[model samples]
Target chain A: EAGVTQSPTHLIKTRGQQATLRCSPISGHTSVYWYQQALGLGLQFLLWYDEGEERNRGNFPPRFSGRQFPNYSSELNVNALELEDSALYLCASSLGSGNVETQYFGPGTRLLVL
Target chain B: SQQGEEDPQALSIQEGENATMNCSYKTSINNLQWYRQNSGRGLVHLILIRSNEREKHSGRLRVTLDTSKKSSSLLITASRAADTASYFCATETWNTGNQFYFGTGTSLTVIP
Candidate 1:
């Protein structure tokens, strides 16, 4: 089976602009997770969507939001981007919620905000 | 931010040697997992150890979880140059089942 896939391997935007990143989970997976790996903050959880619902989120600000589609693919949106928002955004997928399952990740979208 | 902390932020060893990395978390977790990332690439799942389990092994990888200390360690034996990557430990807490808190990651460099 194909692994998780992400689009626009790299994104460039300026301050106050918005950025959208996409992710397609593996077949048969229902849970999609978003993470931000900043220069110093490491990899922090951004959002978790399970069965098309927002299950949980991380410490990120309201500007960072995303949604899961019916096909289990996900979209991460960063609004009013700041220079600090520049980082690698990763998307992962798992079997589903309520059980222990391995999470497979995508290559990640590197966003650079100037 | 219930993120975990990984010890020995960086490590460099010759091939055929053993590499061990440690992770410590803040809250109680249902399971702890290890992942490997090559530079800016996506992460690859290495191993997962449940709370009730103390130790588990797969191929040349061994993972040990200690709920008492809220810590876990990953051991990769007979390391090869291909094993050179950033290893991270993520935790799925009991309170938040879907969210995973990841550590800063330990960058390992295996020289051939």
Candidate 2:
């Protein structure tokens, strides 16, 4: 089966602009997760969507938000982007909403905020 | 803000050698996982060890979890040049079932 997929391989935006990253889960998967890997912050979970609902989120601010579609696909939107917001955004998909399942990731979308 | 730390930020070794990396977390967890990322691409799940389990192996990879110490270690034996990549450890807490907190990661470079 095909693995998770992400779009807009790379994105460039200004400080005040907004950037939207997209992710498509693997077939038969119902959980989608978003993570940000900044230069110094390492990899951190940004949001988690299970069965089309926002199940959990990280310590990020309101500017970082996302939603899951009926097909289990997800979209991550970062509003009022700041220079520090620039980083690699990754999307992962799992078979179910359970915590025991292994998550498969997609090629991250590199966002550069100038 | 909820994250762990991986020891030996970087490691460089020749082929046929063994590579070991350690991860330490602060909270109680249901399970701990290890992942590998090549370049800056997506991460691939390497192995996972549940809190109840002590050690698990997959081919050349062996993962051990010490729930008491809240630590985990990944050992790759007979490492090859193709194994060069960044390895990360993730922990899933009971409070946030769906959220997985990742560690800083260890970058390994295997010389051919």
Candidate 3:
């Protein structure tokens, strides 16, 4: 089976602009998660979508939002991007919305906000 | 904010030696997971141990969890250069579905 896949492996955007990163979850996976890994910073949870509903979110601002499609694929949109937004945005998928299941991640989209 | 904090921000060891990294969390968790990320790459799930479980092993990796201390340790035996990467510990609190808070991570370098 194919692993989680992300599009636009690398992206460049200017400050105040908007960027959209995409992720395709593995087949049979129902939970899609978005995380931001800024340089020198740990992975920060951005959002979690299960069965097409926004299940949970982290401390990120409302400018950081995303949605899960019926197919379980997800899109993370960062509006009014700031220079600090330059980081690797990762998408992970799990079998279900459970704490015990392991999450498989994609290669991630490296967004560089100039 | 990061819920977990890993010790020894970075570590270096020769191949064939052992590498151990520790993680401490602030809140009670239902389970803890370890992930590996190569430079410029995404993370890969390594293992998961529930709060009720004390230890778990997979291949050359061993993970121990202590709920009392709200911490966990990941040990890799006979490490290889391929193991060089950043390792992070993520925690899932009770009743939280698919929500995880990660630590700052430990950067490990296995010299050949």
TM-scores, all candidates, are 0.97, 0.97, 0.97
Clashing pairs in 1: none
- DockQ measured for candidate 2: 0.76
The DockQ-based CAPRI class assigned to model 2 is medium
Q: Tens digit of lDDT per residue, candidate 3, span B1-112?
A: 6889998899999999999999999888888999999996899999999989999999999999989998899999999999999999999887676689899999999999
lDDT of 2 by residue, A6-106 (tens): 99999999999989999999999999999999874468899999999998888899999999999999999999999999899999999876768788999
* DockQ scores of the candidates: 0.77, 0.76, 0.84
Best by DockQ: 3
Steric overlap count per candidate: 0, 0, 0
Per-residue error (Å), model 1, residue B88: 0.3
lDDT of 1 by residue, A1-114 (tens): 899999999999999999999999999999999999986446989999999999998888999999999998999999999999999999999999885778899999999999
lDDT, candidate 2, residue B69?
92
Between 1 and 3, whose DockQ is larger? Answer: 3
Instruction: For candidate 3, report its TM-score.
Output: 0.97
Model no. 3, DockQ: 0.84
- Indicate the fraction of true inter-chain contacts that candidate 3 also forms: 0.88
Worst 10 residues of 1 chain B by lDDT: B92-101
The interface root mean square deviation of candidate 3 comes to: 1.1
